[model samples]
Target: MASQGDRARDALLDAAEELFARNGIDAVSNRRIVEHAGAANHSAVAYHFGGRDGLLRALVERHHEEMSRRRRELMEQLGESPNIHELVTARLRPLIELLDSLPKPSWRAQFMSQISAVPSAVAVAKEVIGDANLPDDLRFINGAVDGIPESVLRGRAYLLGSMVVGVCADQEAKMNEDANKGNWEQVGRFLIDAAAGMIGAPVTDPDGAVRYPNVPLI
Candidate 1:
């Protein structure tokens, strides 16, 4: 059985996620979150999470545990050799699956999108990332590509992550009891295809030159 304190902490996180998702993170106050959680003590969040940043970190960590498990399973299936598509799918499938499982009016995707856009939220994520064991979804994809600088690859990955978060937020916004499940499936497939191209695309030379096989030189 969960301790009363643990349950109170979880309630705060759930409340915070919904509030942060519906309203921008900046717009939601700590008092609002505490109230929404139904905790008799406004200090429950402070007692459990220390503060807003701590609360945010806890929420992100909760989702990371869910997503990381799925990521590792996909990585195992991909084995020693996997295509870019497979790798991209592994990176994204967890979030998509999570969205599918959440109840209607769920706010997780939008909350994540907010996190991606906020420096504080991103900093919280960075802290967690530093401590956590992230699935190296880019390893095989990195091996396949040639001539692209490591910095460039990192930039592309950042862009790809932003796109995925933003798109899913949009998907969740549009979702309701009347919404078609096919739309969500199509969005997931589209994101996978686009991400594969993005992560695998050849980099151009610094001196205004193109080296990718198909593109004509400028």
Candidate 2:
């Protein structure tokens, strides 16, 4: 038995996710969200979420929760102690899949692009990452980082994360330009290969020492 306020809040959230995903978060107005939610009170968003920033935070938190749930499900499907590649793929795929399945991919792209450009979005992203309690996933990633030095591992992780974010942002731009045409599978494959190659095995001996792969150093 949900209260009227609770129901209104949920409706607002539902409307906000779609609206924010389609339009940039800054572009979508509180009035529009309330209108979209079919709430009789025009101030429903304010009443429910306090204000626009509060609404955005709620949306981000909900997305984090959903991502966590999807990651857990993927890990369960993979069974115990999956390889680094499997772990990374499992964590990354769901987000791409979500964007692909959105009713208006262009809107998602717009939203993501705005998020990429904003400093506050970075803060929100860091909060989500730090607050995420995925021990199994963390263990798998840390194990992958084992052979590499902490500095290199941190740099590599940042690079890999940035690459994924860049690719997603690029995809969104492409989707906006040509809504009817795009090869998500091809993009996914390219990212998988690119990320793997960047973070792939260190060229080394039995002892924990760095070694270059036997090829023309890039």
Candidate 3:
């Protein structure tokens, strides 16, 4: 049997997720969260999650546990050497795996879209992942992109992350609106390909010359 506190905490988390997804995190208030949860005390968010930021961190941490586990398993399967495509897939597959398992009309994709968009929220997310050891595929991917110009590499990483989150959020919205509209595996493969291209693209010089002509862009 769940304790009253556990139930309250769960309720708070649920309400927070729904509200955050519907209205960006900054727009939602602690009072709104408590009210939505049907929690008696106004301080329930504080007691259960410490505060708004804590609530967001807890939400991401909860999801990341399973997501990270699957990612680690993927890394293990690929050993220490994975191609750019496999490495990109390793980074991306966990999110789809999680998306499939979540409740219908899940707000997690929107939540992630918002979280990764805001610097403060991104900091909280990084804090959640800080405890987990880095996966091998991540290390490989890092090394693989080592030759890229530092500026270009950083820019592409930002673009890649934003693109994936935005696309997945849109896809989730589509699925919620019409379940049969989106194909999960195909979408996942497409995202993997997109991310791989972004990371492995050839850097072009101002004179229209490709920095690494030998490297395939796609």
- State which candidate has the highest lDDT: 1
Per-residue lDDT tens digits for candidate 3, residues 1-218, read 99988988888888988888879888899999899989789998889888878888888877777777887788788856678888888789998778777888887787777775456676787666641122233446667765665445545555666677788888888888898977778889899998898888877752432232111011
What overall lDDT, based on C-alpha atoms, would model 1 receive against the true structure? 0.74
Full-model lDDT for every candidate:
0.74, 0.63, 0.73
User: Tens digit of lDDT per residue, candidate 2, span 128-167?
Assistant: 5542222344446766545655444444555565567667
Q: Candidate 1, residues 65-163: lDDT per residue as tens digits?
A: 778789889888886767788888887888788888887878888888787557787778776754111225554566766776665665666667667
- Tell me the lDDT of model 2 at 98: 68
Candidate 3 is scored at a TM of: 0.83
Error of 2 at 200 (Å): 2.4
* Regions of model 2 farther than 4 Å from truth: 1-42, 79-81, 116-119, 131-139, 201-218
State which candidate, 2 or 3, has the greater lDDT. 3
Query: Which residue pairs come into collision in candidate 2?
Result: 22-107
Q: lDDT of model 3 at residue 208? A: 39
